[model samples]
Target chain A: MSLDIFKERGTPLDRQSFTWKDMVGEPYSKLDDDAFTRVRQILMHGVEQESCRFKHFAARFNPELRLPLARIRRVEHHQATMVNWLMPGDQSTLETTIGFEQVAIEVTAHVAAVEPDPYMAQIYRFGLLEDFDHLYRYAALMDRLCGKDANNILQSYTDVMPGRPTSVEHRAPEDDLRLHYQKTRAAPLTKIHAALITGSEWQTRDYYLTVGPTFADPIARQLYAEIASIEEQHVTQYEALSDPSETWLEKWLVQEATEVYAYWSCYSQEQNPRIKLIWERFLSYELEHLRLVRELMQKLENRDPAELLPAEFPDPLSFTSHRKFVRETLAAEVDLRARGYDIVPMDQDSPASIAYRAQLNAGGSPSEAVAAGYHWRPGTELTDRRVRDAAFAPLSGQEAAQ
Target chain B: MNKNDRPTDIGINRTGIALSPLDGPLTAEGASAAPPSSAGSWQDAAMVRLRYAAEASEFGHMPPPATLRGLAKTAKELLKGHKANVLLDKLGERLAFERTGVRLYDGLIVKFEANGSWEGGPTLEELVAFRSDEARHFELMVQALVKLGADPTAMTPSADITAVESLGVLQVISDPRTGLAHALHAQQIAELADVAGWDLLASLSETLGHTELAAECRRALAQENLHAAAVARWLKAHAEVAARGELEQAVAS
Candidate 1:
């Protein structure tokens, strides 16, 4: 049966009717493989959607509204936590960490390809490499800690090779704000893409923030802390692409609509019965959220909610192997750095040079340190030299520097 | 189009009221006064229409207003019943596993297509279907994570296991030196292990009060069992082919 998200509003359970006991969802161990994948997609979409939604509200000039918006974000965060903890008991933390990097790699690559704005696409590619490097770094840890190869978790789909070495990923925060898109002229997909990516990067930052402290290995903890900082920069770079001129109400409407669109997309594509039901249910919930935002817009500004968004869904975001796209991008753009909207080749002497100095000043980069630790103990470096060499071949003098 | 007609009068019939004057000569003084009718150009008119068309296109992509109202009502009810369930570690593992599954299938598809048809073995169509199923599994796992309000990108232990296991298969598939036989052997091994893993997960989920999840595992287990069996059959058939060729060579000698 065709499920119409617009018409199918779910009945939200009453607060008094349910206790804290009801808040705890059924913790399942084995989801059907298809079902589990759907769940992950929906959750990833929600995490990004909610974060973008919260950011829009939080950016409002009105101080009085901040508290309410923050509360909403907190609830969303609670929801995100629930979605995150659905991992089976058999999986390890290191294994999951690899999964996170894979998401960053694959999802970023997917978004980059479809991203309408060239500037935004550039940023996606730039971060794609660092995350690629991160996968290698963490894979090394997986090997050291568990005596397992990184390829096992990656399923050998993503190459466990360096992109742009994470050692050079550091840059001045001032350089982070490269360029912004004009909101009025930008495509709806562009806005959603920015929001989606910003949300994903922000969540990654937060994940590292919480998980970094729990690591017993000093180097591992340091690695988390270091990578987390890069995520922070990634968040900065991606969020900068958002049009700051957008009104909070407009952003809110877009967020709700995006959530609906994402859920609907998942529901449409879902083959598994149980997961499809969840997608339908959530699509209904998000539709309700969109309705409330529309009302607030009508009441507050008397503006039509229809004006803010389009009548049909934009292109759906699909997570697939971007191995070829990523490899090509790595070959071409590995040595480039963002200077405002323009991506220029890296030049240590150029006035625009911020990353090189930033890297040198940050002391011994934890990224390199992790690699060194692996080398010192295991008698091998983290990445496959062949893959690493090929990816960096375009960068002149990179071999000597390494 | 008479010269006497105001520039604004030209396209006024086609495009409603002109926001800016359509036609006038520009002088330094005129820049401040009515902008010297810069808006009267056909280019300007076309741009205006284009903007309208863009806005119209935007509307096409959005959900209808009625749907929004329905969603808002549902959201209000949900807010009242909102409660958080914390299951941090397990969700992390599941997310990792599904993510790995996606990459695994992706690599396999690439390998299968690049290698072309396996001699007297499973067709590319069959491989594509298997890859699609893996993609579907990845999507379901992602949805489950989202429903629970968790971040699927977070690092977890199970992901490490998935990465390591998938890596072995990837190594065989990605290397040019390895052929379909090696790939099939790798697939058989992977599928067998997958079935065992799913079986264990299914029982564990049942014990943990996740009957739905257990059922899901059983479904995956069934698929894995088929996959393993197919690979085994293909391997046997290939071996027979080799044996027959060797026998013919001996007879000729």
Candidate 2:
């Protein structure tokens, strides 16, 4: 069929299904409790997956996620494009440590979820890669903006006491969750610690809307606005999963209580002073956000702001009945293949190498790779040409060059 | 002279020095096989005539004289009825001043005929010069709507902001050449076609200020869309080709 006919006939993919919101100009005070919760959940989920990736990267390479404090500097236009300009002094610190971590988590999730469609996979991967680039840029900017050791925490996490692998084989979800409990449960047990990485993301929609462009430098402001648009799409997606008819008061009370408790619990047991600071800052931001939401809601629904206060601070965390699976293989000493490296992390029976192996297995045919929406890494074509030229003389350029 | 005279007397007519008998049998028995002057150019003229007739019939007639008089009564409210013309002239002026842009309203009946809506509606021009500017506007609009706590997709203008409404007028305006000449001067359209051809070029150039790479890319992508439509003509002309799949695979690879 003609692309036009196909485009015309094909139903537009549900933006709500993709976790986007429709453009409604009404203040967020309109969202119901369930909708708010759903939005929060989605946001938190994005953050959670993002944090997971950050953890892996930190564990593997002690790259600085933030710039040191001594490098305090003025913000640039481009930097402000993506960063929330409304955020004032010391935002560089926040961006490096928290924002970078969040971005990593988001990038990883994108890779896992969005890079499967043959047509869009490359663009999505590029998006994730762009996120990665943004992550490093933000970290560097933080370094320049503040003169603190942005890498200090990560360095310690990697160098001071690297955690030992407890499993031999690739672990399943049940095993992974169980192991998380076994290893980190005793290390810290706060409702907030678990919930810090939990919750939905609808608030950022409001947060960016409320704050981003105000302080963002020109380019950064533009970038934030664009991203905020995408975030609005995110909000819509969350709303679709929940009821919209519920009152805004209920949603705010529930979400605020949950978020507040989660932060309280996480901060209480956090060993790193920086993490505590982050928790406090995030809480402050959330409080302001909650305040704005309440005001907007009151104006729209003619309700009292005081009436929006919660019954009691919610519990720090609610434990899920999530299970962790056991790994079937053990870690082994990997031979570095003529490089003389003695030991390295070995991929036993895990899907650690799934994507990479997929690439390798699908190599040797550019057409096949194109069919799979995979581009050959730079220089692969040259390598293939060199090998082929050694085999075929007619097509070789050596004769022509001579 | 003898040959010319014999042929001229025999019912041949040659006006130019280079003119010659068709070098084939020209008899009542063979006339069925002979081509006519109306075979090519005449046929095109006929088609053009038919098309205009159909367009006229489809549109029917202009609003009654009374309605137009009523419109004139509230002329000031409608910017003296000159706003339309002024807006069009302003838009045309912008295109005219651009380094590489075409005025959509200028020249030819088909140009006006195809984009007839442009005649009555507010005139707008796209500055196809820069892809960034074009992209930036949509992005800005989308972003601004989201920041207002509005859904970008849900952005149906309940009421028109005068400026935004004006912008919308320009948005719908298109070049006349591509819009109406598809049937009338089909061969001319084909000959004038480059990668984007003259119509898209003119439209994009008139609309956007720059011929940004994105516009080019978009145009190429559009051509890909057009290629499928042109398949029958392509296949008929190229008898040496294999099946459709082979053709597509060759192009795809």
Best by TM-score: 1
lDDT of each: 0.58, 0.28
**DockQ in order:** 0.01, 0.01
lDDT measured at residue A35 in model 2 versus the true structure, 0 to 100 = 19
| Candidate 2 lDDT for residue A379 | 20
Model 2: per-residue Cα lDDT at residue B53: 50
Q: Write the residue-wise lDDT of candidate 2 on A204-313 in tens digits.
A: 44455655544323323333453444344333322332223434333433343334444444444443353345444444433443454455556667776444343344
Q: Chain B, TM-score, each prediction?
A: 0.56, 0.18
For candidate 1, the TM-score is 0.52
Candidate 2, residue B173: the lDDT equals: 30
lDDT tens digits by residue: candidate 2, B66-86: 123323343323323433333
Q: What is the lDDT of residue B160 in candidate 1?
A: 57
Worst 10 residues of 1 chain A by lDDT: A373-382
* Candidate 1 segments whose C-alpha is farther than 4 A from its true place: A1-49, A52-78, A269-272, A348-363, A372-402, B1-253
* Model 2: CAPRI class: incorrect
State the number of backbone clashes in model 2: 69
